[model samples]
Target: MSEPLYHVSANPHVRDNGSTQKIMLDVIIALLPATIFGIYIFGAPAAKTIVITIVTCVAAEYIYQKLMKQPVTISDMSAALTGLLLALNLPPEVPFWLPIIGGVFAIIVVKQLFGGLGQNFMNPALGARCFLLISFAARMSAFTYDGVTTATPLASLKAGESVDVLRMFEGFIPGTIGETSAILLIIGGIYLVARKVISPIIPCVYIATVAVFVTLFGGHGVDIQYIAAHLFGGGLMLGAIFMATDYVTSPITNKGKVIYGIVLGILTGLFRLFGPMAEGVSYSIIIANILVPLIEKVTMPTPFGIVKGGKSNE
Candidate 1:
């Protein structure tokens, strides 16, 4: 075929080699270790939560679309991912109906109502997680591990108790379903970075900032265990790696991402140290998601061959 005169077109004239299905599939693979580890730690109840969340989320999306005369797109796996992430953020012992409510809100109100998939302004799972956290603080905060109520390491720290660092690193402690295992979460994060499904800068900066902040101002000053517990004891790893790095909700520019991560890290530190809540990752990520559009706007790169005042830079 011969080249034709340049034709005018709308946006997205070019497409990447990746598809929505392939990207979502990679996310599923990355999340598998943490999801399975969560189930293993929490046992059958955890399994039930996971299955209920996935089914409810997928069904909500399908049914809403069919009723509204829109094409059903649950095959893309976005709803499944949302459900899984929301479940991971929940205490394993929550009522099964909780995930069902969260699933409906996530898909119908958070995702589909905002134009679905790529159009949503915030991370659906984190939004649902925050919603649940607020409305059901009693249930969401009461964590049970091995049939006993336990404060998460962060909460224990706030209560002036020391935690076993090794158990925290492993998956032996109680918290949310997916956030207890720092090792498994790190491995999954590495896989996603290797597969190029996500950039490492966000998680790295977020975690590093938390480490540095706690190390500098942890009151005891420079204690390794103090910093480690703050880093590995809660949802920082899970939120930074999975939810905060969401394509639709996160900044598109590299610089914007770094700044966003820094903001999250600082906000998290403030909340952990001063705020009443023990875990700040969920709140930090949700707040950052809301600011993404503004971050992108400010960090937006100047057009090629264009300079300030509309002059050519070239």
Candidate 2:
């Protein structure tokens, strides 16, 4: 027989030059404005938290990979990204050891133990945040701005106290290190969309859904300040723009993505309005992450030549 010239791979026959490192670098770049602003606003403590968390995450990944005889992938920057995300979620006033503990749990337990990177069932940073939030509620909930302890705008709103919407929008209010600035976070989200790193559907839908939910059921009857407080006064923008859109944890198809956004929006609205906590972004995103598989399964497109019930049309 004549020698064959064609070659076939198992699947994913087409590929692109884009890499995990490049994508992570782009995300890191997108996050810089908020990160720098946070450091400038919170001073050395924020910087310290960021540095320790990132280093701990990177080191944990490196050591674990080495010990397991796996190829070291610390250079990929996923661990660094996870650490940065976790630190941003934390109050800058947290003890130095907190981020270290968070980083270790994020990398070793939520990430590596689950098979690392794409294999993780949830965002590692968020998993760690929830873990820390439950374990150290007081520390995690404390907020400070300009060295003075204060209630976050969301907390004030939850307590029926008037909040300075302008300050919250401008990120001058006390909150987590990175989540205070709505404008800066929006800018970063815009950059991500421009780079095609993420789609705008989830964010837009998620935000819109929250706005409508709060407006209809908030008992404020279209009060702009109340809506604005719910929107810009918490971690909603940060979570919607960055964490909830995580590629591995989010839905892959457009339909699935839209459904995912709705679920996130409703869950967040429920938690913030009815749950004991004033903030719900982290919990909402993590919960939605766990539902991504079901979303994708239902929204998966039928094959070109296949029918709805798996019968061939050809």
Candidate 3:
């Protein structure tokens, strides 16, 4: 007979010009600037970590699908994207095996075990980053440049110390692989938005909310420089623009996305100002991802001019 069919969505015509492979390729291309800039600053170790992570993630998916008799999806590039995102979130000086383990966890535990891809509740790469961060806090927090270790700008900011604002904007500040460069991250985000790969709603509102929150809750009387530091420092730019915008994990409707962005900003601000962490973008995004279903449910659109009982506008 006939072969079986797999269905993905009711709205089949969306992204008409884009296949999974193609969309993923766009994401990779958009992400390249920050990744390359990161490597340029961090050197061979960063490149090696990224390569190992990507290889391990792809291999994990291949092996899992092969053993389980599932369709092989390595060519879709999701696994590679997860690997790249996870590697970028890692400390540049992280051990070689760190990304290897993180890659496996991202593909096997976070993605595949949850039925893969859009089925997963959270972003696979981010989930893996939090997992590794918890399991290897020391390694994850350690940052080095030119054989000297230093705290990230966020950490220094938390300690009530001054940071080189200009350097932080220029990506010379100490941070994770892809998070140091605000300008490059914004450029990548703009590329995705311009290409219609993503909507600008979430990122705009998320960053705006954070800006307003820090301004209102200013520790030193709410200056523009402090706000900019909070904006460009740590992973706020990366998380707001990229990680929090994951299609599978974020809200679908425009109204739902607005609520999601607001919640993320509030949580991130709370965590940074009150919680014991120097930065809270990862936790904020994860929390927002978990609540996407609720937000969408509440903000779901009604059929045009119709009531709850399906009555017409008459």
- TM-scores, one per candidate: 0.94, 0.95, 0.94
Better of 1 and 2 by TM-score: 2
Best by lDDT: 2
Candidate 2 has what TM-score?
A: 0.95
Per-residue lDDT of candidate 3, residues 1-314 (tens digit): 99999876622134576887887888899889999999999999899999999999999999999999999999989899999999889988898999999999999998899888778888888899999989999999999877689888888988999888878888987889999999999999999999898899999999999999988885766788888899999898888888898888998899998999999999989998888988899989998999988998788888888977678886
Instruction: List the candidate 3 regions with Cα displacement exceeding 4 Å.
Output: 1-13, 309-314
Worst 10 residues of 2 by lDDT: 8-17
Decide which is better by lDDT, 1 or 2.
Answer: 2
lDDT of 2 by residue, 1-314 (tens): 99989875331111457777888898999999999999989989999999999999999999999999998989989999999999999999799999999999999999999888888889999999999999999999989988799999988898999998888888888989999999999999999999888899999999989999999888898999999899997899999999998988999789998999999999999999998989999999999999999999999999999999999999
lDDT measured at residue 72 in model 2 versus the true structure, 0 to 100: 92
The lDDT of each candidate is 0.88, 0.91, 0.89
> In candidate 2, residue 192 scores what lDDT?
92
Q: In model 1, what are the clashing residue pairs, if there are any?
A: none
TM-score of 3: 0.94
Sort order, lDDT high to low: 2, 3, 1
Residue ranges of candidate 1 with Cα displaced over 4 Å: 1-15, 309-314
Cα lDDT of candidate 3 equals 0.89
